[model samples]
Target: MTRQMIIEPAGQAGLTAERVREVVAAHPAVAAHLGAADPGRLIVGGAAVTGRDAAGDAAGRAPFRASVFDPVANRGVELRGTVAAPERAEVAPSAWRPTPGPDELRAAAQILRADPRFPASGDVVVYQPMPPLADLERPDGTTTRRPTLGLYTPGEDVEHRIVAVDTAAGTVDWSPAGVSPAMHPGDCESHLPEPVESLRDRGGPDAVRLRVLDGGTELWNLIVVRPRASAPQNPGDGSGVELREVRHRGRLVFRQAHVPILNVQYEEDGVTFRDWQNQETRFSATGTDPVGWGWRICTRPPRTILERPDNDAGNFQGVAFHDAGGEVRIVSEIAAGWYRYVSEWRLADDGTVRPRFGFAGVRNPRTCMRHRHHVYWRFDFDVEGSDNDVIEQFDEVAPGVLKATPILRETSRRRRGTARFWQVTDAASGRGYRIVPGGHDNTADPYGIADLWFLRRRASELYDGNPDGDNRAMLDRFVDGEDIGRTNVVVWYAGHFRHDQNAPHPHQGHIVGPNLVPVR
Candidate 1:
């Protein structure tokens, strides 16, 4: 295994994104590849951290991954390396065709708009849909699946068709005629403005800390990671709000909380298109800034709450803490293609932690189509500390009775009729949190089988890591039957949501998750 280097300051400042990009561009391999590539068609994005498990060596050198895309040539090269010294850097073997980043998505849109064959007339809005690309059959009858981008018009009614924009070949093609015909005029307006290049920089503080209080009493404190700092190269590491060292009244509750695995699978007629959170397009988590789509501080009565006069840290993606109704809420929005995901966490004064995932659609045809959004959260509970933590599963045996089962080994289970909830407690003190399922937290299908997964904490198992759509919801692979009775444990909770245009909730905007009630 490549010993990952943690980017930190030892005696000097760590490498910045610009410095890493300079080193990568200067590498012999990258330089050679650029020699033959057209400068006009080249798109280079900022370097991003690659690994979460760092060696924390004295050098403070960190692994960085970047990409150079040749839209005209329809090819991309991924460069991974570390800048060890001012004059020395290392580049790993070049990996081909990484998922499209924000830059690539924009480039694909431009390519499609320039093509004479593109049929769009009015304002053409481009989006990176889940499974951003599509399978195309050439005139020779040979089939090829390339990374694709989608385009649509916001207000006007147009015949709905998937415009597969292959950025690599600089080609534009439409999906076969038999698919869904008209696009759904969604409820929410599409505001997917291009990501601000300045805000997407990866060179900044490792994490931002926030403290919540109800006038005088300290409710809780936490460390939240920005999009770039969350390490997008790692599986399940990118694309959501990440919180660490969450404490309630000085008591350690959650070591970490984030959604590393998000699957947005679409079924049009009989054709299935699988999309992942981390894989296709590197969707930037949005904030209420220039785009008006990120976090906000609001009162319990649905009014806007101002930031504390003394707490002028400026919002990181508009994340703010406001104690309303004895509870504090932190919500962040992520624009994945045309779908906007609202990741919210509510921490109550009484010690109840509610993590919610809300699904809303922008102006797109798929918004009215049938689809399933499966979200999985990896919760690292420390209770008081990291050691002596235990997980227990509770089931309703009778109409008014319940049964508790101590899970001794790593395993995967589903929520049936009697299966209720699970709890993670400190074995010594019996202080933990009960994970109660929410009403919208539906069951998993074969593609997403497990409702709950309990496993011993392993850094390698932090995420599924597999971006291939063919392997959907494989969290069960982490269940190797390892003993987890009396050691540090991690809980993987999966929530499934079905969105159909014809349903009562036609808009398909709903929140699904669990409530973490403190147990003393």
Candidate 2:
């Protein structure tokens, strides 16, 4: 009662639909692929048809629902409509009718308005089924169910076994057969280093200390013992050195645990001692990148400072000290290929630190229209007790550049507020950029304007003596161009603010920040 039809390129010479079906039936794989479809259905490379209506003309148009199955992509796209010619001469027997409502009319209007935005036209109606009842299917094509039972107990591991349960009394009890012996804090003098007699004499029992020095540099020094524990455990034998109880004078600064070679000490002249452990410690500093990147760091305690060249392949390249505060800031001229582009840290007065980085900026430069330059610094620190905390503050210092070429223009209706200026496109990558409303003001004072002009003229000197000459080149490039001299870089400002509940239905007078980058 059913028949099969094959579809191929329309212009293929001497190729018949019946012959293609015979070829498909001869191959087992092709037959299996065809059998996977609904019975009495004929399938082509990209389309399928069911020959159920024998009386209907093969070319006659009919309205029937089509559900396309894409096995390779594991997707089903359903299209509802009758097959008809461009002139709609015939109607199909499978057509179904549904009552329309005002909501459907409005939805149709919205769809019509959005149709112009895309290149092609076809009513795409999607049907999404509810999730399956079972997440996994068993070998027998049924779902495996879980057991509903109380807590399970394995008898072999039971040390204190439960012999019985009193169901009526609603209670169960067990007893331990034995208890493990407690550990004692015995004499721990084996880890002590040989005590220096001369240093102990100068600082007394309360001042006996140890310090770590790196390459003759005093990193950290702290009191190791007090008078209360100063009594030598073995006395004259110099075996178990001990100190008495007394208040220690200096602070204990540990080196980074990862870098064992880096030591810490305190020094006045050139002499240093090994007193403190070279363990992880945190500090702060501030410095500009060799190529003009800016950075700042703030900490509660002093920190160890380390610096390398801008060409060094790491997160940190330079360092600076922010007065007496534990602030170490560094900036790198070139951005790292693997490191994050930018990060902002919110430092609270109560020692709580919140960090937010540029998560959206990690784009591959080959495909991305934007390029990011970043600078970063690191600190090492040590604190007493297990709960050491540091608060860090971060800010955006420089805005990156964006380039685009002009596209369309709006000339008339200027007073109606729909006019726009020049639109530019990037020559290298055909991405478009717009030059919206932007300007600069210098109305503070005549002398102030003069000073600003002079500073702008001599901005190259601000490069100072950084290792990267690229900083000077950037300054020169900014000053030499006419557009750079007159044009103001786009500034994007965004923040959260409170609004009143009684605001107008369509609020006006508030300008939301510009959408500079596309968010995926």
Candidate 3:
């Protein structure tokens, strides 16, 4: 009785990066932006493939999109077209400036070093402390985005200084490092890893396509895309390290899984920074390959591991995969202005899935400031296919007693201080997976809206909310109380990390997520 899924795999390969750029460059807006800019200042961000149409039907030729950001002009453009027809690519001006890609970041560092206000140091490392965010508007209604860079001397554990340079206005502002009074013992004093030059240039496979197996029995087939640095200015375009497909033991577990919204709100501070607010200003992965850019396959033992690129000083910074005995892990180190994000996915030999996100900061102005990191992971679970799936909420009502309720309609929920979790099962087969909260998973504040959200699957509703227009969580807007009984269900889980400078790990260098254990 299991209903067959109509949704096509989102991992379908798309156009080549070179072809995507050619298509994007042909658009008038892009051509003009390129023509006016100084050579090499224009950044062409990576392209993402969208496999389905808005109506949820398979697109014969999946469309691919690329973004172009002009640092000097402080403007961005997004172009879209199908792999089969790159010449017909459509283009639109972006409402917000795109995040500075690896190339742009390097260029920004050079600018910072040239300014007289910059500390005279030749051995300093540079990185973006946080993912680039929204535009700073002027009184005249003109908006501009300054490329911000963090500077730190190698091996120094002290707070770092930041430089925000407006390439368009030929102005620069430097903010020296400051430590919060809350800083104390156990607060992380590590600096962000310096950018590796050849890491972005190396190209081999664009994706990690694997059939995870143990002793000749296949556990799952996984296809993952590295986190995208920047996306279009569209509402739901900024998804991170996409889990294109996760099929466990021959049944589709997740048709698509990704964190589209990563919003940060500094508590009480006048300054706020958010990533993926729009399709723009999102952090791109570390590599340069279009399809598999910023992804690496870790080599075992004796060889340095690339999977742990966020390791402290004097550690390996190359590969992004690790063999953890029963599970294979994939990690992507994403650079924001002064902070580094570790986005990881682990597939076990026993059909377990662990998705993790870590927040780490280098020496920077806000390193010790209190803030909340809100990350929303979208799980498009298609148990045993798609249509017959049911959503069940589990709560411990009494000592060792659990109550389960079928979610009949779309709704937003919170943990509410109870041992609460959720399950997605196929009504026909009674097969499913339980989503268990991680130890560090915390409750959301008022700004985070809710901790959990269940909604009917909609191809158009990729992102939970837009971070650009508003800093508060917006996933609640998608819950219109639509029928969700026995149908494709998309589960949204939000992980809240409260960065209190006084607490241990003040830099917020910790990983948080959930475990997906199969219900056999």
Write the residue-wise lDDT of candidate 2 on 202-268 in tens digits. 1111223322233454333322222112111101000011111111112212211110010111121
Question: Model 3 scores what on Cα lDDT?
Answer: 0.62
lDDT of 3 by residue, 1-520 (tens): 2211111123335555556556655556567655565435566545556654422434537776666666666666767777667677777776445565556556566676677877666676665555353346679876667766656664546545455666666566664223222332222434444442212433334345555556566666767654442222232445556665578878788888877777778776544556642111122223222234234344442121122344333222322555667777765555455555666678776778898888765455565667888888888888788888788988888988999988899998887666478998999888888988877768888878888898998865764445446556677778898999998889988888877667865223467798988887
The candidate that achieves the highest lDDT relative to the unseen native structure: 3
Better of 1 and 2 by TM-score: 1
- lDDT on C-alpha atoms for all candidate structures: 0.60, 0.20, 0.62
Query: What lDDT does candidate 3 reach at residue 223?
Result: 70
Candidate 1 has its poorest 10 consecutive residues by lDDT at 303-312
TM-score winner, 2 or 3: 3
Please report the candidate that would top TM-score against the real structure.
3
Candidate 2's TM-score: 0.13
- TM-score each candidate: 0.74, 0.13, 0.79
lDDT of 1: 0.60
User: What would the per-residue lDDT of candidate 1 be over residues 421-510, giving only the tens digit for each residue?
Assistant: 889999889999998988788888877777889888876676475555463767777888898988989998889998876773533237
- Higher-TM-score candidate of 1 and 3: 3
